[model samples]
Target: MKIALIAHDKKKQDIVNFTIAYTEILKQHTLFATGTTGKRISDATGLEIHRFQSGPLGGDQQIGARIADNEMDLVIFFRDPLTAQPHEPDISALMRLSDVYQIPLVTNLGGAEVMIRALDAGFFDWRKLQD
Candidate 1:
């Protein structure tokens, strides 16, 4: 499965820790992430992630395109809702694209954990039918 990862500045650490804890499961699939989040996750978990530009610089749109094209099976976006983002439109687009495509998106640590667990359990294999 192809998994897209994104994290707001404040939630980067949470995403890193979550990735680290689930590294074994995640290592079994392809991973993609936005610039800084990808670098931070790679540093902490030693996972190979295809990195795009920073979110504010179009990384969110890049991932959104993948989602729209049905290239991505799941998205884990750890957003800091309490903070304002300069790239709010990009974030909104990503979220909207996920909904439009019917892809599973986890916007918080709790939901991300559930989705990762489901991935580990092979629940996402059926998604291959959509391709």
Candidate 2:
């Protein structure tokens, strides 16, 4: 499965820790992420990730494009709900596309843990049918 990883500035550490904990399962699939988040995850866990622009700069939209095209299967975005984001419109658009496309998205660690486990268990094989 192709997975997009994203996180807010304040939530980067949390996402990084989540990635580290699930490195074994995550390493089995292709990973994509926003700029700084990708760099940080790669640096910390040594997982290969295709890096897009920083989220505030356009990474969210880039991933949304993939969703629109039915090219991305999963999204793990660690949003920081406490803080206001400058690129709110883009974030909304990305999420909207996810729903429109019927792609699964996990906005927090708990959901991500469940999703990752399902991925390892071949529950996502249905994604291949869409392709």
Candidate 3:
């Protein structure tokens, strides 16, 4: 499965820790992430991730494109809801695309944990049928 990992500034550490804990399960699949988040995760977990521009610079849109093209299966985005984001529109569009394409999107640590566990348990194998 192709998984996109994204996180806001304040949530970066949370995502990094999540990836570290799930490195074994995550390394089995293709990983994609926004610039800084990718660097952080790769550094902490030693996982190979395809990196795009920073979210404010269009990374969210890039991943959204993959979702629109049916090239991405899941999204694990750690959003910082308490903070104001300069790229709110891009973020909203990315999320809307995930919904429009019926992709599995996880927005917080709790949800991400459950989704990653499900991924490990083959609950998402049905996504292969869509290919």
Candidate 4:
């Protein structure tokens, strides 16, 4: 399964910590992430990640494209609700694409944990059949 990861500046550390805690399960599948978040996660977990541009620089749109094309099965986007983003449209588009594509999307730590646990349990294997 291909998992797309994105994190706002404030939530990057949380995403990194979460990835570290679930590195074993995460390592079993392909990983993709936005620029700084990808580097942070790779550094913390030592997991290879395909990196896109920074979110404001078009990374969110890139991931949205992948979701639309059915190239991604899961998306974990740790957004800081209190903070305003310059590329809000990109973020919104990504969320809409996930919904339209029927992909699992995690927008907070709690949701991310649930999705990660499900991934660990192999709940995402059904995606292979659909592919």
Candidate 5:
């Protein structure tokens, strides 16, 4: 499975911790992330991640492109809803594309935990049919 990891500034630590906790399962799959988030996770968990530009600089769009192409399977985005984001439109578009493509996307830590577990349990095997 191809998983995309993304997080807002305030939620970076939380996502990093999540990645650390799930490193074993995560390491078995291909990972992609935005610039800073990818660096932080790679540094903390030693997981290899394909990094794209920072979100505000076009990372969201890059990931969205993959979703549109049906190249991405799961998206774990730790969004900081309480804060105002400068690139709100891009973020919205990313989420919208996830929905449009029927990709599994989780926005909070709890949901992410469940999704990661599901991934480990082979719940995402259905994604292979789309290919």
Candidate 6:
């Protein structure tokens, strides 16, 4: 499965921690992430991730494109709700695309844990039927 790992500025460290904790499960699949977040995750966990531009610079849109093209399956985005993002519209669009395409999206650490567990259990095989 192709998984996207995204995190807002304040949540970047949290995502890196999550990646470190779940390295074994995560390293089993292809990973993609926005610039700084990707760098931090890769550096911390040594997982190979395809990195795109920074979120405010179109990274979200790039991942959204993969989602739209049926090239993406899961999205783990650690959003900082208290902070305001300059690229809010792009974030909204990316989320909307996830919904439109029926992709599994986890917006917080709790949800990401559940989704990652499900992934480990092979529950996402249902996604193949959608394709």
How many backbone overlaps does candidate 6 show? Answer: 0
For residue 124, give model 2's deviation from the true position in Å. Answer: 2.8
Model 4 — TM-score against the truth? 0.94
lDDT per residue as tens, model 5, 63-120 = 9999999999999999999999999999999999999999989999999998888879
- Cα shift from native, residue 67, model 3 (Å): 0.5
Off by over 4 Å in 6: 129-131
> Considering TM-score, which of the candidate structures 3 and 6 is the better prediction for this target?
6
List candidate 3 stretches off by more than 4 Å: 126-131
Q: Which scores greater on lDDT, model 2 or model 3? A: 3
How do the residues 9-99 of candidate 1 rate in per-residue lDDT, one tens digit apiece?
A: 9999999999999999999999999999999999999999999999999999999999988899889999999999999999998999988
Tell me model 4's lDDT, rounded to 2 decimals: 0.92
Clashing pairs in 5: none
Best by TM-score: 6
Tens-digit lDDT string for candidate 2 (36-103): 99999999999999999999999999999999998898999999999999999999999999999998
lDDT per residue as tens, model 4, 1-105: 899999999999999999999999899889999999999999988999999999999999999999888899889999999999999999999999998988988
Candidate 6 residue-wise lDDT, 13-109, digit = tens: 9999999999999999999999999999999999999999999999999999999999998999999999999999999999999999999899999
| Model 5 CA lDDT for position 28 | 100
- Local lDDT at 111 for model 4: 96
Q: List per-prediction Cα lDDT, in the order shown.
A: 0.93, 0.95, 0.96, 0.92, 0.96, 0.96
> In model 1, how many backbone clashes occur?
0
Give the runs in model 5 whose Cα sits over 4 Å from its true position.
Answer: 128-131
TM match of model 5 to true structure: 0.96
Error of 6 at 1 (Å): 0.4
What lDDT is obtained when candidate 1 is compared to the true structure? 0.93
